[model samples]
Target chain A: MNIANKANRLTPYVFMAPAAIILAVALLYPIGYMIYASFLDWSPSQRIGEADFVGLRNYVNLMHDAAFRESFWVTVKFAAVVVTLEMFIGVGLALLLDRNIKGMSFLRTIFILPMMIAPIVVGLMWRYMYHPTVGIFNRTLKDWGFEGIPWLSDSTWAFVAVVMADVWQWTPFIFILSLAAMQSLPRSALEAAEIDGASDMQKVIHIKLPLMLPVLIVTLMLRLIDAFKVLEVIMVLTNGGPGLSTEIVAMRIFRTAQEFQELGEAAAMSNTLLMVLMALTIGMFAYNKMQEGRAAKMQAMAAKGTA
Target chain B: MPKIVLEGLVKRYGSFEVLHGIDLEMEEDEFTVFVGPSGCGKSTTLRMIAGLESVTEGEIYIDGKPVSQLEPKARDLAMVFQDYALYPHMNVAKNMSFALRLQRMPKAEIDAKISAVAETLGLTDFLHRKPGELSGGQRQRVAMGRALTRDSSTFLFDEPLSNLDAKLRGQMRAELALMSQRVKKNMIYVTHDQIEAMTLADRIVVMNGGYIQQQGSPEELFKNPANKFVAGFLGMPPMNFLDGEITEKSGEIFVQGQGFSVKLSHQKAEAARAHSGRSVTLGVRPSDLVYDPAAAEDQSLLVSIIVSEYIGAQTVLLCDCGGQKVEVELKSTIPIDRNGQLRFAINPEGVHLFDKKTEIAL
Candidate 1:
């Protein structure tokens, strides 16, 4: 190639080199290591190079393991329930608070305070609050002449307790994003909707929610992905106890590798979780691309019409 | 046949009042336009009427019924916004039929209304397209169509054509004028464009500094402006003001200033004689100045042409009259050269005098 042609070809890559290098170090390397380690029967006591090549043994064992399967189902159920609840409550709160009242800024700050705390701290706090004998909730119920219910001891109550903790800590993530989306919506459109004779409920259902769908979809996907990998708070509070009711996949993988010392099996479980998250991420990207394409098509049509 | 009345309407933000005690009445089926520069509270007044902005201190009556506390939906009005404000997620047909559907009208009636408006707006071919797919002009038409489909007692337009390009804005303005004539509803439009105000309004309410300067028919506001601001704001090239003193020259009244002096007409002189020796502003439209070489000295201005802009049939000459810059519009066929000194006679009837301090027309 001529020097000019070579320089032109090199220009794009020159500008892209930093991102490429960072992607290799930050993404490709860890995934590559995990894949290689998943094929070996490794242990915490042995060097990865010294480990035996076990081929499909770990995968075959994972398929038969009842505990792993239970934990996988538990993770899916937890993610589904928590994300659904959080989306409803969060978007509802955003709608109710999306106004210009005094102290709104202060209220918004307070609403998001739970999301900013450390997950471990959140777990500890909620654990104390869920105490059946002496917690504020039970005390209040007792004062109201109600029975003190077992919050964390019974299997069903333990699941509910963990789900409540997760919801409390993460609903704010959806709230802030939904609020920002609501605030940035075209003000003129809302005003036009008002003048078009749409009632308040109709505006919320037909205009606000549909207009906020794109942002809400992305937010839901992000929260669902994060929910699948949740472990810290569940670990600190229930520790996957009360008959495996709160044993999410991340906790399962941690216990598999650390408690059982089965690094290969844990790697297999991690790979499965990674694949689920990858599918979700790909779905989100595809949705965003479709939205952008639709927008561009509309603009082109509008231009042609005007022209 | 709703006659809208705004009585003692005021808007305030905390302690700062933006619209103070505005009282106005619109007869049934009148096209009223609110026009002013930015921050003149024209939009605020329109929003209050639409019930989008709360009336801080007073009441609005429609057909003699108090409706200040009513919601916008209950007020029986439709608005076309500046940005077109089409629902981005809905197709044009659905957008136009939203209000009808909300009212739970029959499906057949809703379909008929949608198709009728769509056909009128020439949007039938693009009925299935979402707003994001339409051009600015098409979106503007859809906004109009949406309002038309509602068939409300009143229609409000808040600078609906301001978002379109210059050519598109002109085209849409013509279309809006035609639509307004066809519909004959009680319409209140707001715009900062003087041309829009002049061409579209049955009555133009010119506002400034959060106050209504003048309100009258377009011709009345153009020919007999109550203030210098209205005079300058209503014309195409704008009226020019020359700082001059009202002087009594040989028992006749003349406005003499830096570059030229012109004898006031009998009526103008009578008005100016009351303020003799007081500094005043001489207002003259560009169209009022005609090129004349043999005109009398006090009736004509000797100006040196600095720049001549030829716009097809009419040419605008920027001339220096003494130290003041004055513009004169003449036939493009007139032979004029740069740096040439020329005399242009002022029409006696076109002369306007204003108090220099208050800018009120005399």
Candidate 2:
């Protein structure tokens, strides 16, 4: 090939080189360093040259650590519970507010306000609200002739409080996505359903929900991933609580490296969390690929039928 | 079978009225078609009857029962929309059986109905495929199958074939006609295509500007249109119109225009004499202009042929008659030179006269 032809082919890669280089430095380098460090018996007070190569000892030690295991279980439980609640409430609110009314834009804007605040600020705000004595919730209960309830002081109540805060901050993410999916639905299909003897509830159950499934599934996966890695809110509110009740994996990792001074163990825990998230990402992509394959098969069948 | 009636049907969007007091009566088991251009209130009238759109100031009675205030499900009617409107996520069988499932019918009966409809529409093999997986034509069939499974007393179609390609549209149009004949229901179809109206309608209602211009059998409307709009809208290639003045020469009434003058028929002469010396518009169809070399001077049009489009059996000629344009359709074998003058005899009975100012038939 001529030099001009070679240059023409290489031009696109030259234009893309800056972004590729930035990604390598900003993303891949840290992950590679973390993987290497997870195999070392290192402490924050020691230099890298003085650290010993442990070779999977930290990972082996994590399997027997009850605290780490408890934190992992707590993260799984929190993600499952909060994401389930958020999906239902968010989709329900989207359905209720999908129509046009006066000041609807303002109402939608106000609905998503919690998602816009910084996570630490949201945690602080909820912590004040869940205060055992002086919080607005306890104050309102006392005003209603009820005794002040233990909110953040009790382990069970602390879990509930943290879950509520997470739901409040993240439900809007699902709500906006669900609302967009609902609005983009084929209008004529709903009208046809109405004419086909479908009542309002039946229309929602049969037509609307089924059509919004793809968007809902993707949104649920995203929320689950976010919920697994949640830290700041629980850190500011309960600090892992009276027991390990509110100790999610992310918070446990932070406390391990800072409070326990075990950098190697923390790195090992983070690697485990990273593997779990990678599996979830792969599962999501597999599901999307399967759906695409089925669609392509149907299109082929339809084309054959026409031919 | 049910008889449908609309009394003082009015539809308004805010302050602008779209349907102005439409009153129509459809007979039992009749295939009535409402045809007009877009924004002419035909689809609005059909939608109001389907209960998709609320009637502004009207009462719709089906089988002598008022149903204007009822929900669409309360009224026993099924509608096919311009878009196919199939459930994108549901399989073809599930989409078709949704109504039966909603009614809480026996599972066996629902399955039977779905299978029968699927077989009829040739969708049996695609019963498990979602609408998004299907082609446009298959989706259209699914939409039809969904409505057919309902077995409603009335069937409403709002330009259901408008989205299909030309060939597929013709195929679907034939199938629709066959289905309508086999299942005799009170079918009301709305479309802007006049050919669909002429082929599928037991009675064609031509509307314009929110008003019913004329309603009659296809042959009746084609033979004698009530006004100029009705005359021009109901025919293929459309009717050509030329402005002329009605003049009396030697005690005979004649319609005189730029490049042609023809003696009026005896029946038309009486109508022309009453408006002599007044301006009028002459309406003629392309098929009515015959190619004749020895035609009398007073009975023919002298036209300069500009373009000839050949379509297998027939050729459509675009010709200029003085300053006015007219189309002439003839057999392709007949030789004709482009940009040359030609004479075509006018079929006397095919001529129609309308008042220039009012555009109403004289």
Candidate 3:
């Protein structure tokens, strides 16, 4: 009987062993290798064992390098601006379209089409649209008797062009999630608010937005994480040009490994980006836990009161 | 208090009409209940009056002003929904004080009103809890408290107690009666439960198939239902309906059915003489049938017992009067053997006759 009891306790771990082994081999091993490789001076021409050991030299060099600092600032700015714009536009569109008009389902399907396209495909599509004189934007400008402006040749215009493209691609994700959230809200509460003498603006400000905060917060975090790792579209557009003005950190890390041939430095840059995303994910989980804890405590007090 | 009136009110969804030209007048501080079956448009009428539904072809007047085109907030009324639509995120106090805060009332006055309403409803102890944290009964009280604190000229309840258990519903029904008496406001309630209508209504408007069948005081409606549907809808265990024919035999009026023949009283005979040899229906309440073995033949019915349901204080027996089923409410002490026939004497005053074709009282 004692042996049977021990076997019963070990059953769950025995079942979980295969998944744990696959995770170690597929995911954790590469990450561990990257962290170790960040501390060496290495190149693609030599094996990892032949590389010289360097203690924190790559990180110190990154702090003093102006180009690296500029790329890091650009990445931060790009994520902040794109996430904010996507949230506002997405939530606004959801509110505007939450009614039973004719062909509403068809309109909603078209709205989410931008999000379903492949990222590389979206980059290619926008690259054609932003072409210098042959592009639709410049052609329309010239047809209206105005001078055709450079879309990708100027540094400031390239940054603006990339931000607009990112916004166009990702805003639909927030819109769909928020529309589902709005539809699932307690409908009777909204009717009650209408009977409570609330105006149109007041109802949206007080009831609709406050109730949608949880889904909105998680959507913001997800979009921010995706924004930091953006590289495909910018790579196809200007290749980090007009002289490094739009070189986001991900593109810089790619160039460092492929073009500059500094494999160890590139690994260090990737590690830094990973840490920032980790902090954001942890903050989201902590907020969710705090909400759940408060709910559970209220339930306990209610049970005690009833008892 | 306001005198509310619905004049020729009509509601339609696209081409299909729901309420057919309803006309009603509620005096100051009257508790009127609209009772009907499902799809009977009782709730639709209440919602039209509350401005939640648009009136397609009529006018609603509050204190003698046409207000059908107005918004719900501009109607100056409070409503308690069937689902207890309390805000899930707001605490009990905030949910109750939401309307007052929107009006921009003084903070001190709002606090005082919230406390007073909460204390009356026995919700003071759970003032800080959200709707999710409270039990079902407490959430119901909070919904009531929210309506009470609004101080509107009228209060509307749309089947508020139908969601509670049987025991809790009885308790809340009594509390609603007491509250209606305490607060002298024009109250309109809607429910499918006849017992709730009979207990809480000063005037009951019985509806069926999107039309008002009858409207009167409970005692008047019970004694004299305008039609057969009203008669069957407003009583517990329902009034028994038996098909019969009116006949004149030896200068007396009689209604004869399959298994039995009953003589009418002098007053009823005189009134029923005009419709002699006409097909008719006999309506009798279960309470009017007494278990009397020595009753006269023309005044009683002989039936074979089928099932005896043993409820405390009374035993309800399901019996067959010839080919039709009939129910009788009997005292538990009545010596009734399981397999034999029994005689139930009918009260002459309790016999209700209706025209077979029209289903209207004769």
Candidate 4:
């Protein structure tokens, strides 16, 4: 009987073993390899076994590297700007569309179409759109008797163009998630708010936004993490042109390993990017844990009442 | 408090008409309850008055002002939803003071009002807890406290206690009665529970299929329901409906059905006399049938007990009268033979006759 009970308790772990093995092999292995590689003075020409061990040398060098510092700041700015614009535009669109109107479902489908496109395709599409004389944007401007703006040739314009393309592609993700959250909100509370003399704006502020905060926070963290590592769209559009203005950290890391062939520095840069994203992921999880902990405490009290 | 009137209020979703046309005048400071079964439009009517659902083809007048096109905020009211729609993120005090805060009231006044309502609702202890942290009963009280703090001229309740357990529902029903008395504001409560409607309503409006079947004082409606639906909808164990035909034995009128014949009371006989020899339904409450072994055949039904439900003090017996089903509510002390047949006399005053086709009281 004792053996059987032990076997019963082990059933769930036995079933979970396959997934655990796959996760270790597919995910943790690379991450461990990357962390080890970040500490070595390695190059593309030499095998990892032949590389010399360097303790925090790559990290120490990155601290003084002017190009690395510039790219880091650019990555932060791009993530901050794009995430902020996407959040506002996405949540605003969700609020506007969360209503009953003719052809609304079709409209919502159209809104999310940008997010469904491949990142490479989105980059190529926007690059053509941002072409100085031949692109749609400048062509339209010239047609209206205005000077054609050099979208990708100027530093500020290149950054702006990349930011625009990033916003266009990812804003739909935030919009769809926020719309689901907004649609699932307790409808009767809104009705009660209406009866409580709340205007439309007041209801959104006092009730809807507060209820949707959890989903919005999680969505924001996910967007920020994705925004920091964005490469294809910006690479296709600007390719770090106009003096590293649009060179995000991911692009820098790619060029460092490919063109410069400094594998150790690239790994260090990737690890640094991973650490930043890890902090955000941890913050998101901490928020979720706090919410769940409160809910569980309340639920335990409710169970006590019933018992 | 303002007098509320709904004139030809109609609600239609596409071509499907849910509420046909309802005309009602609710007096000031009245606790009027709209009671009906599910899909009977009692909630839809109340939601229309609350301005949640738009009036399709008519006008709602509050204090002689047309309000069909007005926003819900323009209607001076407070509503407690069936789900107790307290802001999940807000504490009890904040939930209660949400509307007052929106009005930009002074902090001290808002605090005072919230404390007063919390004290009355017994929510003072849980004032700092969010709705999620409170138990169901506490959340219900907080919802009530929120409405009370509003001090709106009209208070709307949409099956507010139907979500609670039976014992909690009884407690909340009593509290609601006390609150209505203390506030003396116009209260419109909607529920499918007949007991809640009977106990809490000063005036009960029984609705069915989008029409007001009957509306009057609780006692008046209980004594005389306008039709078959209202009669069955507003009573416990429901009024037993037996198909029969009205007939005259010399000058006295009687209602004859499959297993029994019952003499009509003098008042009902006159009405039955007009519709003599016509098919009708004999409606009797479960309370109207009394255990009596020595009653005359014309005044009693001979029925064999089928199932005996023992519900402390009272034993409800489902019986078969000939081939038709009839339910009887009896005292537990009453000696009943479960396998054998018995006789139960019908109270003359409790007999209700209705037209077979129209189901309208004759």
Candidate 5:
């Protein structure tokens, strides 16, 4: 009996061993290493054991670095703009497409096609189309008897091009989520709204949007986190060119590690980005927990009332 | 209040007709109930009257104005859906006041209307809480309160009480009866439960196979159902049907079957003689069959009781009369010889005859 009890108690841990090992090696270890390296004056040419303990010097240096500040602002700007535009356009498209038109399923499948393409391919396609003199956009402008605008060479236009590419590739993520949320809503409520004398616009504002808020908020947070870490697409497009106009923190961290050979500063930047993302993830979870708690409380109240 | 009319209302889905030209007129302040089984199109007809469904080949008129092409908002009516259809995000007060606010009514008036309806529904304390916080009965009341606050010419109910527990359903049904009396609006209700139809309706319209089988007061329908379906659909333990052949002996008409023969009453015998139909069915309600040992054998059923179901004040005995099955309802106090055959006298006034082929009352 003692042996059986001991084995039964060990069963759960035995089942959990593989996942715990993989998590420690693949996830926790790298995060722990990055946190430790952020406190060091490490060089890529030297081994990690030979690096001197710097004690917050890299974070302090980042605060004073003008380029880092500019890149930080640029990242914040890009995230705010892209997420805002994506949210509006994505939710708007979902509302407009949530109808029983012929071939609607086919149309929805076509609308999300851009999200399915590889990000690197999207960057290449946009770069080709944004060529100075030979691109389709300039060619179209020239054909229309207008002067061709420099799309990629100017700092402001570079930022705009990057935003456009990000929006095109990612708007569908929010769109699909919002559409699913809208489709799963209590249909009778919408019909009731119709009978309640709400106009089409009123229905969207009062009924559809309010009910879809939780899903939209989570989608917004995910998109924001992903927006801050955009690296590959921007690298292929502008490579943080035109006086750091489109240089997000992730791009700056990359250039610091590869070109500047400052491993500690790169690790510090990675930690900062991770902290911001962690804050957003925590905020998302808190909101979900609050919603779940509200529902549970309501259920308890209902049960008490019945009792 | 407005007089609502459905003229030749037809509904079709991809060439499959669900309602085959339903014609009904609901009087002002009348409580009309449409009752039927699933897929019987009672709800479809109600939805059409609410303007949520487009009429395929007919017109719905409210107060002599054709409103089929109008929006639901323009129809001057409110409906309580089966699921309550309360907005999950809105509190009870907001839900009840939604339509009034949309109409741009004064805030003070909306508040007054909401408070009044809430008081009537006993939802005063829960006004600030969302629909999720309320119990099932409370949500149902809120749905009712929402409709009540509308002050529309007609109120539509689509099985609003079907979701509640049996006890709560009974309570809400009583409340609805009182509310309908006080409100005095033209109310159209749809339900598959016969008790709801029988209890609350001023006029009950029994439908089957997407067609109106019969429409009348509850008593009229119970006493004289126009057809076999209406007769069987309305009563509890559902009016028993026994196949028989009408015959004459010594100038007295009798309906004879395999295990029993019943002499027809004068009024029913005259109709039976005029029916000119070969096969007929004798209808006897459980309440019509009274246990009497001294009753005439020719006018009573000789049935061997098989199963006795005790339900409080009454016990229903399922019996086998020859090869056919019959049921009887008696006081639970009555002693039973479950294995032996017994006689239950058939009430003459309750003797209903129908042409078996057409299932039409003779």
Candidate 6:
């Protein structure tokens, strides 16, 4: 009986052993190596073991470096602006297009094509569109007899251009999720709202939006985390711009290690970005767990009441 | 109170017609029940009256004003759906006060109304609980409370108690009947259950195949059904139908079938005389057949017991009359010989005859 009990206890761990080994090797090993390297004065030219030990020097330098501070601020601003715009446009479009119309499935397929494109391809496509002389916007402006605006040359315009591109590529992610959430809503409640004298706007505000909130919040968080780590699209569009205006943290880390040969500083910058994203992921998980716990508690209470 | 009149109301999906031009008029503050089997368009008719469904080619008038094109809220009605349709995110109080709040009633007034209705529904203690935390019976009560709080002139119920267990359904049915009396709003209820229609309705409209079969008071419908379907559709231990031919012998009418022949009463015989020598269906209620050993041969049936189901106060026996099966509800105290055949006297007043071809009453 004791042997049987031991075997039962070991069963789950035995099944989990392979995944645990893969996680340690593929995920933890790289993260651990990066953390260790963040404290050393390492360069790509030298072996890691031969690098001089420097505790907290890279982090201390990051604090006072004006370039690093500017990039960090820019990353935060870009994520905030892009994610907010995407959420509004995406959720609004979902609400507007939820009903049946001719060729709706084909239209939805066209709407989501941008998100399905490769990031590199998206960057190249936007690069051509944002071209000052030959781009669609400038050509349309020239035809309409308006002065062509600088899209990617000036620092401020470059930032705006990158934000627009990111929005274009990611808004469909939010749109599809919000649409699925809207479709799965209990339809009878909306009918009840109609009988309760609610107009179209009132029904949307009172019934539909509130019920779709949980899924929307989680979708928004997932997009926020993705926006923080964005790199390829901005690289092809602006490459940190004429100045350091659109230089987000990921680009800064790339340039720090590749062009400047400061692997330690790049590792430190990557760690900071990773920490911010970890907090967001953890928040999303915590929210999901809370929702599940409340649902279970409500069910348990109801079951007890009935019993 | 408003009177509702449906003049040639019809419903169609694409080109396929579901309701073929229904016409009905409900009086002020009347409790009307539309009862039928599934797909009989009873709920569809109620929904059309509530303005949840679009009228295909006719008009619905509320208090003499046309309301076919109006929105549901504009029609001044509230409906409890079959699934209750309670807002799952809202507490009982909020759900009840939703329509009131939409009208912009004062907060205090809304609260007082909600509290009063909640108290009546026995949901006062559960005002703060969301629908997810409530049991099935509690949710049903909240649904009722929501409608009561609306204070609309007309109320619609679509199988509200169909979701509850048998015991809770009985309890709620009693409550609904009592509440319908205390509150005199025009109520239209739809259900497939005949017992509910019989017990709660001032006027029961029997529907089949999207057409109104018959509509009348419970007693009128039970005693004199318009057709064979309505007779079979209503009543517990449903009315038994036996195929027979009406024959006239010396100014007397008799309906003779496979194993028994029954003499018609004077009034029914006069009605059947015109259709003499014609095939007809003989209808008798299970309660009309009483155990009587010495009844006259023409006014009684002899049957052999096949299956006896004993309830508390009655025994429902499924007996064989020749090749056809006939059920008789008997008092459990009556002694029975297990092997011998039994005879039951037929109540002449309970006799119903319908034309075989049209299935209409003779």
Best candidate (score: TM-score): 5
Please provide TM-scores, in order, for all candidate models, with all chains considered together: 0.96, 0.97, 0.94, 0.96, 0.98, 0.96
For candidate 1, lDDT tens digit of each residue in B51-128?
A: 999889989999999998999988899999988888888999999999888889999999998998899899998899
The CAPRI class of candidate 2 is medium
Over A105-178, each residue of candidate 1 has an lDDT whose tens digit, in order, gives 99999999999999999999988888887787788899999998788888898898899999999999999999
Top candidate by DockQ: 5
Compared with the true structure, model 3 gives a TM-score of 0.94
By summed lDDT, which 10 consecutive residues of candidate 5 chain A come out lowest? A298-307
User: Residues A1-307, candidate 2, lDDT per residue (tens digit)?
Assistant: 6999999999999999999999999989988878888998889999866788999999999999999999999999999999999999999999999998999999999999999999999999998998888899999999999998788889888899999999999999999999999999999999999999888889899999988998899898889888999999999999998799999999999999999988888999999999999999888888889888987887787787667
Q: Once superposed on the true structure, which residue ranges of model 4 sit more than 4 Å away at CA? A: A1-18, A302-307
Per-residue alpha-carbon lDDT of candidate 4 for residues A129-151, written as tens digits (9 for 90 to 100): 99887899999999999999889
Task: Put down candidate 3 lDDT per residue, A103-190, tens digits, no spaces.
Answer: 9999999999999998889888988999888899889998999987788899999999999999999999999999999999888888
- Chain B vs. true chain B: TM-score per candidate: 0.97, 0.97, 0.98, 0.98, 0.98, 0.99
Q: Residue B324 error for model 2, in Å?
A: 0.5
lDDT by residue (tens digit), candidate 3, B1-362: 88999899888999999999998888889999999999999999999888888999989999999999999999999999999988877899999998999999999999999999999999998898888888778888999999999999999999999998898899999999999999999899999999999999999999988889999999989989888999999888899888999999999999999898999999889889999999999999998888899999899989988889999989889999988999999989878877888899999988899999999999
Per-residue lDDT of candidate 2, residues B1-362 (tens digit): 87999899999998999989888899999999999999999999998888889999989999999999999999999988899898877899988988888999999999999999999999998999888778889889999999999999999998999999999999999999999989989899999999999999999999989989989999999989989999999998889999999999988889899988989888889878989988999999988899997898788888987788888999898889989999989899988766678889999999999999989988
Better of 1 and 2 by TM-score: 2
Off by over 4 Å in 2: B337-339
Better model by DockQ: candidate 1 vs candidate 6: 1
Ranking by DockQ: 5, 1, 6, 4, 2, 3
lDDT of 1 at B241: 86
Q: For each candidate, what's the DockQ? A: 0.79, 0.63, 0.55, 0.70, 0.80, 0.75
State the interface C-alpha RMSD of candidate 6. Answer: 0.7
Evaluated on chain B only, what is the TM-score of candidate 6?
A: 0.99
lDDT of 6 by residue, B86-108 (tens): 88888999999999988999999
